[model samples]
Target: MSDPNGPTVRRRRLGGELRRLREHAGHDQAAAAAHLECSTSKISRLETGQGLAKAMEIRSLLDLYGVTDESERAKILKLHKNAAEVGWWEQAEFEEILPSGLGVYVGLEYDARAVQEWGLGFVSGLLQTEEYARAVFASLPLRPQDEIERLVKVRMQRQKRLTQANGPLELWAVIDEPVLRRPIGGPAVMRAQLKALAESAAQQNITVQVYPANKDVHPGLRGSFSLLEFGPADPRIGYVDSPSGNAFLEKDKQVRALVATFDRLRAGALDPEESATLLNTLAAEEN
Candidate 1:
């Protein structure tokens, strides 16, 4: 739950700049590593934003890359400094659960100016109520009760971003029809959840659309995916989370594919007003 300019995002921006500089200088990882007296893997990790670069190390890399522009060098150095700051998710409470790429995903979500999500089997996490989220986690066999609570807490905390008045993250969600019909956490929980979802969709920054079950097969049948947008400078990120694994799509081609899929899904889905009406109708049925 880091703020917009979180460390993870800064690391990515800096890493991208470094990679660009190196490529422009015609230096591969091997050459850069030799210049810095570090292993190639270290260079790779920094370029991938998986590892932070120390100021001295960044300076050495800049020097090696033949970066003569003082202002550009200063900007890169500032990125390094900002990326070194500790993120809120690094707190002791989340250490155990965040080892997976969820930490990075959360950071990106916080820093994102907007997000587009397609939910195939369940409601989007950003729209889930506390009880609905708790039930979803508790359903996992043999999961500790404490762990379920922590997961729910993390989900609820993420929703707070939607409520922030200053530049609240714009959310566009496309939900499959079956997801709304499934009585997660029993009918009562779903009833409340649906009502809440409709209210959320009513907000200025949030848009909700439903893909009817009656339609022919669509791209979303492949699975759920999300696109996180950080405006022009940073690359758009495509995200996929499933039981098998989680993937963050950073390459332009991969992100573009996800974008195409989402656009198709949105085209086939109900309009926002109709989606809200359907949610209300379904919620009423649960009573």
Candidate 2:
């Protein structure tokens, strides 16, 4: 019931802890609600992360559960406060332009520690230059002009998660050769995009791999997907998106399969050094 990959991330964690405490106290939902002077449904919503849990209500629950440890109480209160805070994606700036599923994905990506992504058709969003992102958004058959601009803004903003002052997020991206050659936004745009990719590959936190066009068909032919490994502070999430929308895969089994697939793709794709050389050579050809 806890969705750790959305705006309610902290709320989800708080809810889980509240539920755990309730169970440990041997209090049923009805009992806990009676003690808090609220409806059982309210308690249920809070426990499932479908609704926010207030710090006052949390304190009441703690007392009801006989939890005396100050540290535990402090931790739960902090989580409650964080749960109530708004995420960047939830702000009005992107409200209408961002799709719900994609919003949740952005929230998850915001907290990711490392990302392993496979791109079969185009540059992955994080690696795409502003020009490339603009071209990609503009190419959508029926998308409105304003919407394209907003989408581009969202992608560019999302890239910031990789360069934050603290240990930046690690990105391992494998792009199929055809995508690199596809001339997404024309030669000039492609050249700039390739140059940007090479530059990013030079950075310590980013890994760029090109799956050669001449190599035998590989696992990525199935589709594009990303495995987002979250820091210990958050739950790990996997993302898969298509023309319609995006989906999150949080189950251990499903996530493991995606991880294995990525390992195979990495094994099959060019090493970073070779990929850097190829990207540079491709950019030179575009001149």
Best by lDDT: 1
Please report, in order, the local distance difference test score of every candidate based on alpha carbons.
0.89, 0.84
Candidate 2 deviant stretches above 4 angstroms: 1-9, 18-77, 233-235
Model 2: weakest 10-residue lDDT segment is: 1-10
Error of 2 at 5 (Å): 13
Show the colliding residue pairs in model 1: none
lDDT of 2 by residue, 1-287 (tens): 12234455666678889999999999999999999888999998798655776678889899999899999999888788778877787788786787656776676677667888999878989999998999998887888988898899899988987777776778999999999988988999999999999999998899999998998767789889998876466656678888777777778898888888899999988999999999999999999
TM-score for each prediction? 0.90, 0.79
Residues 87-205 of candidate 1 have per-residue lDDT tens digits of 66666677576538787788788888999999998899999999999988888888888888888888888888899877888899999999999999999999999999999999999
Instruction: Give candidate 1 regions above 4 Å deviation.
Output: 1-4, 31-42, 67-72
